[model samples]
Structures are given as structure tokens and as C-alpha cells.
Target: MDIFSNHKRLFLLVILLFGTLTVFVAIFPALNNQYSYEPLPDSIPLTEIEQRGKMVYIGNGCVACHTQQVRNVEIDKVWGSRPNVAADYAGIERTNFWVNTATLMGTERTGPDLTNIGKRQPSEDWHLTHLYQPRAVVENSVMAPYPWLFELKDSIKITEKDKIVNLPARYIKDKSKKVVATEDAIALVAYLKSLQQVKLPDGTPSPEFLYKREQKKHGANESGGSSALDGAELYTNYCASCHQTDGKGVSGAFPPLDGSAIVQGIDPTSMVNIIMYGYNAREEYGEMPAIGQINDLSLEELVALMNHERTSWSNDAPEVSLEEINKILEELKKQNENQ
Candidate 1:
């Protein structure tokens, strides 16, 4: 008993417990700073159907595959809006939700990012068909069909003779004797419609509007001596390899010249500047090599080429002049020297 009493095991155990508690208290705030719970909108409120669908989204583990955040580089390179900011989530009231706490913020993207999914494809019927069978629309999509999200009813009698309605497939019974969407698919569609991309900044011109104006101007000069046909041929030889024949581009590698506001905008000066001097290294996509160094095209040739690209395919930018090109080149030289 006297030998045991001389030991100090209790003192050592107390010191260890205190040290562990102290460390945890110090680090807890930093660890929990990643996610913030916010309330949804009240004006265009989420309906009971949408709420049920959200529950299904969580239960099905959709977040395991998709991420919502878009970084700054991602926005510029992918033609997406600016990176997500905390102000975007400022209005939501705090409440307990089924959040993925392991990553604190969210998981890595396994599929296409869903941040602006609602805006990307805005058709409800398209989403319904895609959910029922993805291969029906996107040939390369890997997402599994979520048939269980739909309410299944068999032999629903056709009511209106004039209306052509597609019926859901026959329902299958589970071990519990419950009928489900041949896979239960509609709930997931509701959830997808709720996920909208963030709004763009004010004063940003839509590609469609810009293209229409370009077309109107081009149509006016159709009977004139202008020749976009020659421009088109030149583009095929010089530009098609990097910009692609369609003009949509290779995503993150080549910036889309077609439907680009800068290409179709009122300023022909900017267009000449970009073509003559090449873009600076600060561009989101890698710097375009200085093709102007080749010195192959004369002033008129460059004008024809620019007109062809701006008005080719669905583009409609106004025709540029040789005078405009010379002015832009002079300005570009000055800017280069200043750099």
C-alpha cells in the first residue's frame, strides 16, 4: 500500500486530459468556419413538392457527385460567372440541415458542376426525360437513372382524346409491397429545376442580342460590295484549328470567338487590337501566340478575315475598314511600348 501511494498516475492522467481539451477549444472555431447555413427565399418560395424533392436529393446522395462552387479561374476560362462569394448566401437564416461535414465546405466534382445548372438547360420536360433515361439526350452522360423519384401509377385511364399524353411505365412492387416510379423519377426533376446559376453583372450584353445586331447590319450590306464569303474561306485555313469550325471552342483552352460580345460589340477598334498585337499573358485562357508576327496578311486581308469570323456561322458583327485596322495597330504599338 505504501509503495502504491507514492505513485502519481492520477496527476499524469489529469494533465493529459486538460491538454487535449485546451487544444480542441482553440481549434474548434477554425474547423467549423467552412459552411454557413442560410434561409431560402420567401417571395418565390419553395413549395411542398420542391421540399420533398430536396429530401430525395439528400437521400439519394446527389451531392456526393456534384459540387456547387465556381472559382475565379473557372469562371473566366469556362465562360461562367464570377466565383461564388459569401454575399450570395447572406440572406439565408441559419438552421440544422443534413450537411456533409467531412469536407467542411463540400466534396470534389465527380460530374459537371451544378452551381448554375438550372440556367444551363431550362426545360422541365428535358430534365424529366433525361432523369428517366439519360442516354436519350446526352449520349455520354454517366449518371444513373433515378426512376424511384417518380410516383408510379399503372393503367391510368386516358381522359382527354385531343391531348396526347405519355403514360409512365408499369410500376414494380418492392418487398414491402409499395409501388414506386418504374424507377420514382419526378421528385428528382423538381430538385434539379431549383438549382439555378447565379446572375451575371449588370450591363453585360447577351450573346444573342449582339449576334442579332450584327446580323441586321450584315443583311443591310448584303447587296453591297462586301464579301464575307472570302473571309469565311480565310478563317477555315487560319483560325479553324484553334477556334474550332463551329466557334464554340475547346472549353478552357480556346476562348469562343463566335457569340463573343467583344467580337460583335460596337467597337471595331478592340477587335483589331486583339488580332494585331495578340492578347496579354493575363488572359484566362493561355496567351494567344502573336500570329501578327507572321506578317502574311496585308491590311485588307486582315479586314476580310475579321469580317468573316465576326459574321460567319451565327455571328453578325459589322464590317470593319482598313482605316480602322491601321488606327488600332498604331494604338497597339503604343500600348506595347508602355508595357
Candidate 2:
């Protein structure tokens, strides 16, 4: 009671207690984590361009809508292969001496997590177009366009080396003007592309996702058994982001599977190979990433995905069987080994 009556003494005591609590509860643990954790063996530092792009990402408030972390939950499986660990972020350094929002794990995911976006969508053209106008690629997207990151030129100059983006007729007010991504946009795309999950060293067991939910089959085909994965669900998760639900991909950006010759071809070899190895049709459309290889999709998944593409969007084609896909995979593996 006497000490409480002494104002100076009370203030000093409160300050000391607060400091002690902060040190023991907050500072000490943070320091320990900083010192003990090391980046994964496969982790690579960002290039100078990527660093600049990271700053642009910060300045544009991308963290407000997108998350960088993939939580340890079954639902988060689409974002990453495994749960995030402290080591995942150990390589990240401060943006600068005065600003240190490098570990931008984000509070909530308004958009999808960007933890593995580089691996997920590696097409620079797609990203550039998306940034120019989100709705250009993704219909009904709520993201605002960053038109400032591009320049609309009547014609590309002979000296101009900047890559040009071919937008949809509706999006481009003037057909004569070519949309060019500025240095900032290029840097930002580079940064986004750098946001890949670093693989753990060989023999290191990856963290498991908890609370795994039992997935139901997408229904059996004539040849597929009940064990067949739901191709529709897989497509929705992986393909729907670029190829719309209607199978009509963004014009001039993503090629449509609705009437694609590859999707409706008599032979499934080309389609399967494209899904596994990815396709680059830069002159016609944005490059497609190797979704199958990145996700390590199983035979059932491959069959389902192929069947869905073949049967969907009024495109009639022969559905692939697991046996066929497995044979193709074997051939691909041998080819890779030989290469």
C-alpha cells in the first residue's frame, strides 16, 4: 500500500514487470527461433529483380488479399504439398533496415495462398495479364486492375524490347494500342514467381497435413473403379483458376479446352504429356505449367482429369483408362532417364 502511494516507485515497478514479461514471453522465444532455425537446403535467395518486385508487392498491398503461408490442414493441401515450418521463413530477410515485413504470412486469405504460386502458375504472360486486369483472365474476379504497371503504346517501337500483352478485344479499348508491362510489373511477376516452396533435403521427412478429409469419388466411368479420384473436383481446384468452369479459357490468354483438338483428340498421349510436361504456345496463348508433375497426381487422378477434359464441354472423346495412363507414364519415365 505504501509503495502504491509512491507514484515514482509504482511507475518504475510497472515498467520493470512489463519489460520482464516481454523479454521472457516474447523477445526470448523470437530470438531463439531466429538463431535456431535455418532455411531448407533447397531454398534460394531472391534475385535483385525479385527483391524489387517484393517491394512492389508490399507497396501494392498484395498481402491484404493474398496469403504467403500454407497452414497444416487438409483444406490447405491445394496450396502446398506439406505444412509450413519455421525454416520455410528462415531465409526471408527484412525488406530494409527501417521496414521488415519480409515474413508476410498475412492474417487472412481473401485470395488464394501464394506460398507455391511460382510452381502453380509459372507463366509470366498469364501473371502480367492478370495484373493488368484480373478479370481479363479470371472472370468475376474482385481484384482491381493495376493499369499503372503497364503502358499502352500505339505500336511497339523498333528499340522496344519490353514484352507485349495481347488483351481481349473487349478489354482493349483500342486495338491498335499494345499493352506493355513496365519494369515494375515485370519485377512484381518475378517476385511472385519466386514464391515457391523450397523442398527439404533428401531423407528429410516432410510434415504431414492434419485432419485429412475423406474425398468421395467423382463417380465411376465405364472403365474406372470407385477408387478413381474426382476429376471434376481436381479440375476445379487446379484448372478452374485459369480455365473457367465453362471450359472456355480466357481468350488470347488461356487456350480453351472446350473445343481444343488436343482435349478431343482420338489419342490421349498428347493430352497426358501436355498435362505432365506443360505446354508453351507463347505466340498463341500463355504457357501452361506442368500441373501433374507439380502435384504428383496419381494414375487415378490422371485418368479422371483426362476423362473430365474429354467428356466435358460437349467435347466427345475416348476416355483414358488407368492402364493406358500408367503405360504412358512408364514411357515418359524411361524417356526422362534416357535424356
lDDT of 1 by residue, 1-339 (tens): 443465576667678888888778756653454345332232244455755566566677878887766655523223234555543444333224754322112476666666555544434545554565554444467988665555433435423321211212332243223223422245555656666544434564322211112221223233132443366655654555446677765453457788988789878777776666567554335355344443345676687778777787788977776677677877877888999
In candidate 1, stretches whose alpha carbon ends up further than 4 angstroms from where it belongs are: 1-45, 75-80, 90-105, 151-184, 198-339
RMSD of each: 16.9, 2.8
Q: Candidate 2's residue-wise lDDT over 1-339, tens digit each? A: 898899999999999999999999999998999999999888999999999999899999999999988889899998987888989999888867998866889988878899999877777878998899888877778889999999988774624587787677799988778888899999999999888887788998998999999867455667652254777887886787688898998887778899899899887788988899888866777678888887777787788878888889889887777887788889988887999
Q: Which candidate gets the maximum lDDT versus the true structure?
A: 2
Clash counts per candidate, in order, are: 15, 0
Badly placed stretches (over 4 Å) of model 2 are 1-11, 158-160, 199-211, 218-220, 224-226, 330-339
Question: Estimated TM-score per prediction?
Answer: 0.42, 0.87
User: What's the CA error at residue 271 for candidate 1, in Å?
Assistant: 29
TM-score of 2: 0.87
